[model samples]
Target: MKAEGGTTCGNSTKNDSTEEVKNQYHYPLTLPNYTKAEGGTTWKDKEQVFDKAPKRIMANTRPAAELLLHLGLGDKIVGVGADFGAPDKTVEKEYSKLNILSDKYVGKEVVLGTNPDLVFGRGGLFDNSDGRVGTVDTLNEMGINTYVLESSVTGGTYTSIYKDIKNLGKIFNVQDKAENFIKELKGRQEFISTKLSSIKEEKTFAYLHITDPKELNVEPAHDETFFNDVFKMVKLDNVFKNETGEVSVETLINANPDVLIIPDWNTYDGSSANKMKEALYANPKLSSMKAIKNKQIYAVDFNYMFGYSYNAIDGMDILAKEMYPDLFK
Candidate 1:
């Protein structure tokens, strides 16, 4: 399938923090206050130094859950959660595809129901205001290990994916697993690089983060960011380089990106992509844009594109394949 664009929602703010839905739970708990770190706030690991792999694990996103499965720890995941926007079926299907037997527990109440020992999630997972899962520190205080994905909290490049795996390996007492996983991941990158090297005539693209039909945000192109770095590797010029937030239709029409990237988040309704495409098609200002003109609009999953994980390599691969079909064949 043709994939389009990159993503950069920018540094998250306290006001925009995710709100955890409170569900009924029967678990012992102690919550903690939020503390600010250097660049962002962090939950200090109250129960550091895990002697072995956590038998009961909880990961809140598809990519995180997939990463654990990649490390051959699917059995360790006792509970999983899907994005709030995901359907009930997708929640099960995503995990079952990984051969993991876990339930979708989105809010804190559902999470506590599973009684996980270690939780793997982005900072967004802990909506302290709702006091559902409480804060990350709260879980830690309760003797539950919490490791938030750095990419979500602190931003990172492609290399950070390896670090995530390596860190998990260290915590799980499976350094060898981490190393082997990285080796395979390196092989994936090498293969893509081989494909990328043979390519010429790379096209410029724009990833659109559209929260509403009328408003849009283009991923930061040519910035010192993971999204920029990946596009650089694939040799795609970003039409909206260094741009962010509320890209006007006139500006988007003027920039004229070769391709348009749409995410699963905004398109969660299943019909959203089509609605967006139709809207763009009907707009006199956007109809003539190169992306729309050439049918270069592509829909993609959020985790593989915006997320910082080994899974992101798939995003890179998808971009490369679309840019140079001959390289893939």
Candidate 2:
């Protein structure tokens, strides 16, 4: 699925000098005594059992494709479509090697041409009425299994993401890899939780979307459910939790969250997260806000804030480290 709203493109970039420096600090250390493990929920109720592993798979998004690669299923992917945003640092090499079905969303005919036994992506890729990749039922009738990330269906949360990962593991018969990966992610989550356990108060944060560089008008991202869950993990609260429609600058100034989470929309020309930061700095009305005064603003890649994928855990890690550097150290 595309980044929420037609005007913006969500992804991360390495070329930005500011982004470069922020990537330097890794999560300090996982606590040795944090004993909680991820729940043992299976995907039986959410998905069907595959007769055999799908050999020729067509991944409908960059996140879906990269997750497959991480699962050691790279050879099984016949083609990738709708790879939005900057590539993740961990999977860039493997992602570069995949066949590109389309730079944007692939059409139904193109998906059919690929002759994939399985097509996996977010729910947006299989919209029947919109005519993008058609419905899951249509694909199923054509003898192709369609798997939509459960996170997408359930309004996006880490729990739903885990389910999707577990389901994919069962589909490909790679339960060991899936379990191992989930364990690592859960460890990261526990690390963040353990670090923040000492905090007495929570900081307020807003995830902003800047569509026009010159105008500098910001809107709340559409995927608040996932980001909200991530924020809760890091001890940051969403100021716009009850908000609806376009959030005016006046409202933003009045709310004045402790931190501002902005997206790095790398897909557009002459538009970047740095520009949004600059725009925020230039605005006189926004100067009085605590996020500006304390310099707690962050510009993250689209995937970290909005994309439906397990790498969102990595994004959560980034935010946690940024907000509480001492905890990680």
TM-score of each: 0.70, 0.78
Instruction: Point out where model 2 deviates above 4 Å.
Output: 1-49, 129-131, 221-223, 266-272
- Against the reference, the lDDT scores of all candidates come to 0.62, 0.71
The TM-score of predicted model 1 comes to 0.70
Best by TM-score: 2
Candidate 1 structure quality by residue, lDDT tens digits, 1-329: 11112223552332233211111121123222232332334444333445344678877766677778766677778766764332223234545644332333366766767788887865555655432344665676677777766555444577867777777776665577799989988998999888777566777778777655566666554433566555666776667666645566667767787888777554244556667766766666577787877777776666666555566777677767866788799
Worst 10 residues of 1 by lDDT: 19-28
Local distance difference test, candidate 1:
0.62
- lDDT (10s digit) by residue, model 2, range 116-223: 988887665565543367666677778877787766543567787778777777677667789988898889888878987888788988866666645545556444
Clashing pairs in 2: none
* lDDT score of residue 208 within candidate 1: 77
